[model samples]
Target: MSNLNSLQYFIPELFLIVAILVIIVVDLFLKKNKKIVSAYLAALTLVVTIFLAYQQYGYSPALLFKGMIVLDSFAIFFKIITALSTLIVIFISLPSFRTKAEYYVLLLIVTLGMFLMVEVNNLLMIIISMEMVGLISYVLVGFNKHDLKSSEASLKFMLYGATSTAVMAFGFSYIYGISGHLNLDVIQQSLIINQPQALPLFVAFMMVLAGLGYKIAMVPFHFWVPDVYEGAPTPITAFLSVGPKAAGLALLIRFLITLVAHPSAGNAANFIQNVSIHAPLLLAALAVATMTLGNLSALMQKNIKRMLGYSAIAHVGYMLMALVVFNNQGIIAVMFYIVVYLFMNFGAFCVVESLTDKLGSEKISAYTGLGYRAPFTAIAMAIFMFSLTGLPPFAGFIGKLYLFAAVINQSWYILALIGLLNSVISLYYYATVVKVMFLNRQENAPPLRVALYNKLLIGALLIPTLVLGLYWSPVINFTSRSIGFLFGK
Candidate 1:
């Protein structure tokens, strides 16, 4: 399609860019104490973006902007998820942090970048979008300028992020040199026709994976997660855990689909043989290492944010397991897990944010006697913890079931076994938090009360976590439809 014709399909992103500029101007005119107005405005922008993105659903996939971006069910679905996650982060920020217009503006920009990250069909667009998200994230991580740990975390994140970007760029240069093409579809066709040397292809891809891994906090690239999560403002940490991670997964899936044999080719047995490199085995190894390291490390953390940070990495491993199959079922499982994860993970962080506000500490010890001190809050937290652990009758359990079923159906027994064991290991730590809250109550602890707004928000997140457990057909059907891409039926 011509650039002018593409403008119709690009309406949502165009609206977002205008919204962000308007937010910056509005913030400039507001007094420092009145910055809360900007927060409300940001939330309203995201709500409108969500509706606009939803309207694009069910349209046949089409490439826009001279094939730099693709508008499809996959991209639209992730756009809605990213916008919703940011909207929730705004509410999560409202209760605790001093309202700052700049923070919300940065968040809006980050959301815009994520929308591009999932839709990019060219290498140039991919690097531009990833860096956009990365640069904005550095500012958000260190937004708490008064805290030394926050500053330190920002420095570490910046250093690592820069190194990974350089490595990925180097890899992309190699790909372009060999294929003589910048578009992913062209690159895939070139690689298949030329059949490049396996060693160089493997190394180049691995380098590119480094950058994607850093975004998702995959192990070996995960050194920055704990400190950053513990130091950043709680709401930003929550946003980092879910929003960008989902975007990274979307990018990974799209990249992999380009290289592997198409599902419609009717040669499932030779899927890996068709690819130039051993992507399946390499990804499986990363999945195992990521989950094991995250679970083992989380067992010893004292801070709630740090523990959850590691837990986030482990969940990435679970999602990666779905990718091992490289089929429609695996993609559907991934989409379903991401939707369920957004609610349960964000709900857990909200509880932690509320407790931190009340007690001025994020230490696990602060949770002592929470069962009696804050019964409603404690019960809601228990549900979140259980769901995250993938226990029965929770949305997370259903998510895991689909993922493991996808893996096992393809005869990846060892990968499935490792994932199962990791789930059991996760239970011990999750249950420990529950036990501390309910079983080891401190004597003479005073009763605590959560704010009405917080209680309602917690209830809002909790109901989905429980309701999806019992009846999840709506989400399952939505995700199953949303996995369609421009190149697939």
Candidate 2:
């Protein structure tokens, strides 16, 4: 599809752009609760955008913007992920950021960036979309200028993002030079037919991986994650944890599927140009390192936010484990994992965000005796903890089951074993939160009261976290259909 034809499929993104401009103008005139009004408008904008994105789901996948992007069920699936994550984050944000209308506006821009992140089909679009998201994220991380950590985090995040962008662009330049094209499919065909030399292609692949890997918190590229998560406002941390990360993964999967790997028979994937690249084996190692490091580091953290920060990395490792297979099984497992992760992670963060205001601390100790002091929140946190830990009867368990199943089915027993041990190790820290909440006694403690709206928010995220655990066939089926089109091509 050309630019003009792309507009019909591009309504959601365009609407988001128009909404950002309109809300900024609206914020100027409001005297009271400007942020509140802007937040509601932002919420409305996301709701409408989600509906528009859903409308795109039934259409056949088409290359849009003259082959710069593709409109497909795969992209639409991730669009929903980004939008739902953003929509909920807006509600979670309103409580703390009611004074800054611009805060909401910045969030809307990040949402726009995430939207572009999943739809990219050209190598140039990859850099452009990532830079757009990265720049705004740097600003969002430091939105609280009063806090020194926030400022420091913003600086580190910007530096890291800039370095990764340059490396990615450098790698992409090699690719474009060799292929003489910018569109991913065309570049892929060039690679297949011309068979570029091994050394340059290897360097380019790793460089590009480093860039995309940074977004998903892949190890060696993940140094910025903990600091950024801890320093950013809780709501922004929640958004960073899921929204942009999903976009990164979706983009990565598409990049690899389109450029690096090709269909091998009915259900296998392999390097398009060379078998010795061992991409799957390399990713498997990263997955192990990521999960082990994340779980071990999280065990040492006292701050709840920081703990969840490491936990997010571990979850990324789990998703990467599935990516090792790089087939329909792998894609299905990864997609389903992303969906469950969104709910469980948001619910956990929602509890932290709701409680940190009253407790004055995000430490695990702060939650001691919370089982009695704030039973609702404590119980909710415990459920999220169990889900995050991948316990049975929880969505996280189902997510992990699919992940491990995919690897085991491929006879990667050793990788699956390491993943299992990591899951067991994670139970300790996650259960630590549960233990502190239910068992530790706090004498003369006051009863905690969470705001009605925040409670509503928790419930909104909670239902899916629980429902998906016991009954998730519909979700799996949906993921299968979404990937069917992409893999079919």
Candidate 3:
């Protein structure tokens, strides 16, 4: 399709661009006291964007912008995910950030960047979209300008992010030199026809993985996660835990799909055997390291946000296991788990935000006697905690069940076993918070009060987390259909 013709399929992104500019101009006229209007405008834009994206469901997959971007079930699915995550973050952030127009503007821009990240097909687009997200993220991490930790976190995040981007760019240069192509599909065909040296190809691919892995908070590249999570505003931390991570995973899946032989091809094993590089085994090793490090480190955290940061890393490890399978079923499982993970992880962070607002602390000890003071909030938090631990009758359990089943079906028993053990190890830390809230007591503890808005939000998140555990067939079917990209549908 011509670039002009592609505009029709690109309405959602165009709308976001316009919305971002409108928000910036609108914020300039509003006084400090009226900054909430900017937030409301941002939220409305996201709602409209979500509606536009949802309308794209079931549409045939097609290349857009002269094949630089893709419009398909997969891109549409992730666009909705990013939009909904932004909307929820806005709502939860309202009470805390009453008059920060710039903060809201940066958030909208980041959301726009994420929309592009998932749809990218060209290597140049990938670098542009990722840098857009990364630059905005650095400012957001240091939004609390006067706080030392926020500044430090931003510095750490910027250094790590910059180094990784440079490494990825260098890798891209080598690929272009070898194949003379920037589009991923074109690169794949060139590599196949030219049959480049195994050593250079392996090194280039690993360097590219470093950049993608850093975005998703995968291990060794995850040094910035804990401090950044603990220092950034709580709502931003919640958004980071799910939104960009999901976008990065989508990009990874698309990139890997282009390079590897399709799982259905009979020569899949032969390709791996003849090639000197072993992509699956390498990913499997990273999965094990990420899981082991995240879980073991989480065990020693005192701050709840820092602990959840580690937990998020561990969850990425689980999702990586699905990618290692490299099949249609594996892709479906990853999507399903991401859906389940969005609610439970965000719900947990909401509780943390609310508690921090009320008690002025993120330490675990702040939760002592919470059950006696605020029974409803305590119960809801208990459910979130248990669900996160992947116990039965919760959404997280079903998510993990599908992940393990996918790996086991592919005869990856060792990876599955390690994942199961990690789940067990995670229980200790999750239960520690639960125990402090309900089982531990203080003599003179005052009764805690939860605002009506927070209670309603918590309840809203809780229902889905519980219901999906019982009847998830609809979501599973949706995910299965969404994997059409694997089959070239």
What is the RMSD of candidate 1? 1.4
Q: Per-residue lDDT tens digits of candidate 3, residues 1-489?
A: 679989999898899999989989998899999999999999999999999998888888888888899888889888998888888888889888889988888989999899999999899999999999999999998999898988988899999999999999988887788779888777766766666777777788889899999999998899999999999889989999999999999999887765555423322242333336677788889999998899999999999999999999999999998778777777888998998899998999989988897888899988998999889988988888888889989999999999999899888999999999999999999999999998999898888888989889888889989999999999999888777865565
- Candidate 1 residues lying further than 4 Å off, grouped into runs, are 263-268, 272-275
Error of 2 at 199 (Å): 0.6
lDDT of 2: 0.89
RMSD of 3: 1.6
Per-residue lDDT for 1-489 in model 2, tens only?
Answer: 778978988999999999999998988889874458888899999999999998888788789989998888999999999999989998998888887888888888988888888988899889989998999899989999999999999999999999999999999988787789999878877877887877787788889999999999988799999899999999999999999999999999987776567644234444664533668888999999999999999999999888999999999999999998888888899999999999999999999999997999988899999999988888888999999999989899999999999999988899999999999999999999999999998999989999999888898888999999999999999899898666675
What global local distance difference test value does model 3 have?
Answer: 0.88
Top-lDDT candidate index? 2
Residue runs of model 2 more than 4 Å from their true location after superposition: 263-269, 273-276
lDDT of 2 at 41: 94
Return whichever of 2 and 3 wins on TM-score: 2
Per-model TM-score versus the true fold: 0.97, 0.98, 0.97
The CA lDDT of each predicted structure is 0.88, 0.89, 0.88
Which pairs clash in model 3?
none
What's the distance in Å from true for residue 378, model 1? 0.7
